[model samples]
Target: MARYILDHSTRPDPLLAELAAETAAATGESAEMQISADQGTFLTMVTQLVAPRVAVEVGTFTGYSSVCIARGLSGGTLHCFDVSEEWTSIARRYWHKAGLADRVTLTLGPAQDTLSAFDQPIDLAFLDADKPGYPAYYELLVGKLRPGGLLMVDNTLWTGHVADPDRHDASTVRMREFNDLVAEDPRVTVVILPLADGLTMIRKNPDLS
Candidate 1:
């Protein structure tokens, strides 16, 4: 199914393909952390649609996903938060190579601290961080998100283990709990898409008083 979708979807451009190649060669197994080509395509499409003025991404991972989001911005800025200077240094090079240096900013630190310091109203956000930190990141992201703003969360399904009763792992349990929390929260409406791993689309209620 994933193969079929990737086959049908618009493919990444040459520059993006180059970044993917470098990431793979340089990072080895860690390159798997980069968003898949299809997922990157989706991020670009969503960003174009939302046209957010203030975009935030919590996990940069060598800049594949950040590149996708930054490419979609018409005139907005993307603020990326991550804890790895080593990896993000590569991302910086790519962002410069992609001519996106002007539109993107980076802060290297624990996202829990960096994100909490961000005061601007988020028009859109992408969360892909340590699983244990999702709850905290969600709160900060949603709290700063303008009513009706959108937040996309990656890996909420834990490779479909969240639904398999027989597969009880710590990560799966935490993801299930987080999904439940999002589903029950009245402030936002959410739906989990079976994208790579899983992508959860959450929108803060526009009708909130």
Candidate 2:
């Protein structure tokens, strides 16, 4: 099924393909942290649909996803937060190569600290950061999202461990809790798509008080 989906879905552009290859070669096992090609396409589609003037990405590892988001933006700005200079530095080169450097701003710091200082309303927010930080990031992102804005979260399934009764790891437990919290939240309508790990889409209610 996954192979069929990939085969049928749109492929990444040459630049993006190169970026993915470089990321894999550079990071080896850790390259698994990068978003899959299908997920990247999904992100671009969502960004194009939202046409956000301002989008925020909580995790910007190596910039593959950031490139997709930026490409979809119609003159919008993307704020990317990541703590590792070593990882994001690689992203910077690709951003430049993709001609997305102007649209993206990379912040090297704890996303928790940087996100707290964000005061402007956001049209779109993508959360691909630490599993344990999802709750806090969701709180901050939801509060900042304009009514009718979209929030997309990656890896909610945690490779299927989220539903497994025997797996009680900290990440799995936190992801389960986060999924429940979003499910019950009144501010947004949620849907969890089984794309790549698991992508959760939340749209803020337009009828805001």
Number of the top-ranking candidate, with lDDT as the measure: 1
lDDT per residue for candidate 1 within 38-69, as digits (tens), equals 99999999999999999999999899999999
Colliding pairs, model 2 = none
Weakest 10 consecutive residues of candidate 2 by summed lDDT: 200-209
Model 2 lDDT per residue over 124-185, tens place: 99999877788998999999999999999999988999999999987888889999999999
In candidate 1, stretches whose alpha carbon ends up further than 4 angstroms from where it belongs are none
TM-score of each: 0.97, 0.97
Model 1 lDDT at residue 51? 99
lDDT of 1 at 112: 91
